[model samples]
Target: MSHPHPELTTPPPLPENGLRVVALGGLGEIGRNMTVLETKGRLLIVDCGVLFPEDHHPGVDLILPDFSYVQDRLDDVEAIVLTHGHEDHIGAVPYLLRLKGDIPLIGSTLTLALVEAKLKEHRIRPFTLAVREGQRERVGAFDLEFVAVNHSIPDALAVFVRTEAGTLLHTGDFKMDQLPLDGRITDLRAFARLGEEGVDLFLTDSTNADMPGFTTPELEIAPAIDKVFRHAQRRIIVACFSSHVHRVQQVLDAAAKAGRKVAFVGRSMIRNMGIAADLGYLHVPDGILVDIKRLGDLRDDELVLISTGSQGEPMAALSRMANGDHRINVGPGDTVLLASSLIPGNENAVYRVINGLMRLGAAVVHKGNAKVHVSGHASAGELLYCYNIVRPRNVMPVHGEWRHMFANAQLAIQTGVPERNVVLAEDGVVVDLVDGHASITGVVDCGYIYVDGTNIGGTDEALLKDRRILRDEGFITCIVVLDAATGKIASGPEITARGFVESEEIFQQVIPKVERAIEEAVANGVRDDQQLQQVIRRAVGSWVGGKIRRRPMIIPVVLQA
Candidate 1:
């Protein structure tokens, strides 16, 4: 399955000067993440991700990195390493498989399981090379070590990359939660050991660098959920990310404390629980897992439904419940809790689901209404704390927007990191590391690939421009017939317009004037295709502008035959 776009005949060449780290994505934004470490003629890619586009982007599903620069050099590329199973970090696997499916993928057992599920869902079966915490592996010229990191999701890690030039610590999303539901905490001693061994360059997450304060512990939400379960007279439904094993444990614990039977609704939630239980990450009490089909037989107060669609994904269980399509409907007596923040650009979809759930007569609780959800990323204070712990010679902030990157860079400076030591990066900008000193080396051909339907192609700025025009003033199509032999008008010129005019009567009054303009263009003896099309376009545009008092996109179909 080849990508729709032309594959790069050659992968990007190694920097002629020294070791360089290139950020393909996750530098300026939250998703579609990728980072490249180039040294000794080898490249190790860390976490390929996809960014979900804004609502106004019609027909676009996601924004991916253009892999043309690395397509030709798939051999020099060692392995695709995953830090966690978040979509922004792993969503590009299918897209990458379509381009070069043979590359080995390395991650922890849980991350591999999630990726396997995603691959099966997409009908892609690529061979995986799974790794666990404390494991060391080699790919090309780079030696990789996986260090367990505490996060909202299971099996999140901070990758330690060793190259001939130096050692780089790529911290994936992490927090310092000592009492996480999973009982796995970040290996700070290991990071401290690495610091003692010496870190040449440090690339860390900056998603919360702008905020101030430590990330709340995951256990804090258990009491809130317990209150909901205890006070609710009817059934209780909790919606969240299916991969958050810690949060899942919290929900199950809360349900058990409230003496309610738990039933998993979404496939993702079920699969993750199965993995967590098998791996001993989740400690669900025996005989508490009830089937969803048996829900009607249970008392309302005894049932606690754990489901998915925290981001308001349309096909997930929560969305189906909101639309009244689920087998169990939330009546006036049920209490529904949204246990996650709406990912940016998904606000509209989240709001729609909320509206639908409210219409179904269920009480809804979210971040603002209740303390049901907390962010996984570190806040400003936590970011400063991590900076103080590592105390790298040079700091590169990745995984945030431009503003976030800048703010985080400032925070790094404030946290005793010298101003010169902080480097704010964007996609394709290469920061060269020479003997523990860093500087901008050069740029790479890094940009976004828009996925629209089955076709993956470069998003044209012109198309967006035309879409903006259509959004503002609508569109009008003008068809004109000109005599090929004598360059004269032959038949009646027709104007077909939609979304611009309210009624056919308005179009009828506007058509003749449009025809007269076309006749004038023919009378002026325009013969060339470009000239004729331009003339017709301008004439129709002017007429529509005068009538509607707006400039509609005028598409001219000129026929000579």
Candidate 2:
């Protein structure tokens, strides 16, 4: 198997009839999925998306794929083919369009609608082409075909790319659910046909490759959801991904059967479901839907609330309700159902929400306790079936972390794909497909571009480190007045601290240390104000690290008096 090597440098110019595959994101992580496919001097992008910020990423809104590799070549891009409507697959569309607005976006009808809705918020009227399953379109140097794939979201697609160098199949976050709620199973017959036509390289979703068996069908959750709705004594709140149309459909059906009026709570939940219903992907029973404002008119037993934050996003509706910060207070006799799988890295936050809701006397049901959720990605057995059916000459696992991808590669190898043909790569690693074989060529400067509120790509690691320090170790500021003539302290050395439990009296212990450091620095002919500040900073940092055993951010202000 080919792997990224530290010794690898800039890859040689693309060999004749070679397709260079560069992943700007989504190789090492579960989100921020994007890939740049270049051949014949033109690029075809698939699935531009975003990664949600975790607790460690303080104050960050979103994490985007670094477009530096293709920033200069936006004009050379042909079009972007979306695989699905999931945020991890389409959330970054607006950000990418901000760079080059005219890049044509191609996807299924529902997928395009979700993206266009998001793009509308960015005030970008994007150029979009809606295509469904079995449709083919030639975009620049690549011939693309869309295949229907069943996922948590409706109208998800697997893209088949044809070029002079090779044919690459990208299965964007899918599972083979024989009984999907929308009745759209992953088109394995198409996979077999593509295999017969000779697929040179297959890029499959590896999100659940480590799991052992087929994923439970979406239909299997209906009984459980019905049970929840039937047994709830009062107001029922169901939380799921905003884009999960199938789950929402299930919720609506259960609510209607239970004779409860449902209200969409979050802005995204209302928007996406509206789009899905308008586009015929979602089926909302008549008289079952009600406005959130009118929720108060209904009795507790007659009301159902469908909200976002199954993953426990702080600002999301369910989280706010859990924290008692929202208009919908979750309390005694209320039933809160988390109907989505817990996303990796969100366990703590989700558990906290669960505990908070439980503390408020709400009965909480989640994946661990009930069949409320099922994974949308294929497991090892399903991947094996895909590998054998696609029968590609080479395999490159995409859309998963290292373990998931490695397990996927093993599944491919077990299905008769040669071991050496499997390419294991991470974000920024470049792989080139030539003459039916894929190999890692080199790496690119694909780093995380942070989105903090309205600021895109403005937050960096240093700022995040400072935020962590402030959150964890706290910060201390020292104000000192320096005499111009003597280069010594002329007045106060006032110290203040935040985010730590240390007292003002404890800070007094470091006052003399700061004064002595300034005096010694002045005696050594260090008169520069900035230099004096560094001296004071060093003194405070050393004292805090030794006495308090915490390395908080220390700010030293040297003012001339």
Candidate 3:
């Protein structure tokens, strides 16, 4: 059923000479942060991104935005703007560039470097333009200004956009961290200036809106990490987001202070930190960085391992180490520090890995046990501060789940923005702003484009259902050789089952029953291949569902001989 938008009568088309904001994703979910800004016959994209798969989305590698809305409108797209380097904000660039390889891309220095590296992975070379905070550039019908913001990564930015229709400010994922490691704080002064200039619509990150108080500064973790490093008698393994350069800096500082040589573990952690360090976003002390292969040469107390898989990804280095599959095996007396919060939906996997590490006699410290990690999003108090400073006429919450968006909107209301002015937009809902008034004018097809292995959107709902049935209850296949003209069984009926029966004896006992059902369907005057197959499938499904109390996928194959 279509969600009824009482105010929106028709599909939210691009407004005529008015500004409209369309969330491609990242409204009802935590990741895949994309939005479309349209006005003056020109379109600008903000944050084309992807979502990591949950446990239920088995076999799905990545999920992308349905870029179809912009497919026909590509000519109108002036440039694709990136706010930061996080995967949820930049991961889909390669996918988008696959459609239009020459589209102009804009982002801060570190952000663009990360994007370029990612694009190179897909053999894509796109026209690129770099922008920095306090600088302004004109892109087609929109004037873009980059304002500095503090996040987990360096060189984060918020785009201040001026178009023919109105002035819009998009705050990418940010937090009011006064003591950021890089000394590049979120530009409150710039925000004040934007407020004075008058913002028509304000789009802010809603990831931490429900959490009270401001996010803890990046510097706050140094002491805690220092404590961990000081206490660890053997190797200290730290897991964090690869793109979190500030956190990496802290880990490096702690390791250095503790006289431990640091070796980056995980491919992405090595690559990204190398990029950041070369770009001056990260500072590595002389002789402190060691190659991973040489980690065994150093004494346990002299080594520190920093890796990825802070979210407990199965193949990540930390997980491999916990399972004793990594080259540098960790065991008794080792301390594994998870320097990241548990992302929603990853709790089970993360906890399971943590338990595995503990079972291996390694001490584990995470957010629950230590203040080693801080959220990179603005919390309730920080959002209130942003709302008060920008004082935008219309507020649109972005970059979080539904509850987080709603919570952020309520904060906007508390900051004196009218309840009517706050637009709670989900993925695909279009909010149009005119004369400083914002309303839901339309919506578009904003569905997921899943990436499975080498294919995009390869797993449809039916395929997923079949996979679920195969996983949960196993599957049964029935093959019958039939006489083409007489519609009579010519040879035999063979039944096979997988994941259903444990032993050959049990399977043999079930195969005869399934073969009998196929014969019964054939004798019931089922002639057409399609008809007989359906009948056999249903008969086998019902019989097994009753006998085994399971509903496996019943596949029937009618081969006329």
Span of ten consecutive residues with least summed lDDT in model 1: 1-10
For model 3, residues 349-427, the per-residue Cα lDDT tens digits are: 9998999999999999999989999999999999999888888888888888878988888898888988888888778
Candidate 2 TM-score over all chains jointly = 0.99
Cα shift from native, residue 254, model 1 (Å): 2.5
Error of 3 at 448 (Å): 1.0
2 versus 3: better TM-score goes to? 2
Over the stretch 52-151, how does candidate 1's per-residue lDDT look in tens digits? 8765666577889878767887778778899998889998888887766777889988787878778887788877888877889888788888898988
Per-residue lDDT of model 2, residues 137-233, tens digit only: 9998999998998888988999999999989999999999999887889999999999999999899999999999899988888899999988899
Off by over 4 Å in 3: 1-15, 501-524
List the pairs of residues colliding in candidate 3. Answer: 12-442, 12-443
Query: How far is 57's C-alpha from truth in model 3 (Å)?
Result: 1.3
If scored against the real structure, what TM-score would every candidate get? 0.89, 0.99, 0.95
Alpha-carbon runs more than 4 Å astray in model 1: 1-17, 121-127, 290-302, 320-331, 458-461, 464-473, 483-490, 528-531, 546-551
Candidate 2 accuracy as lDDT: 0.92
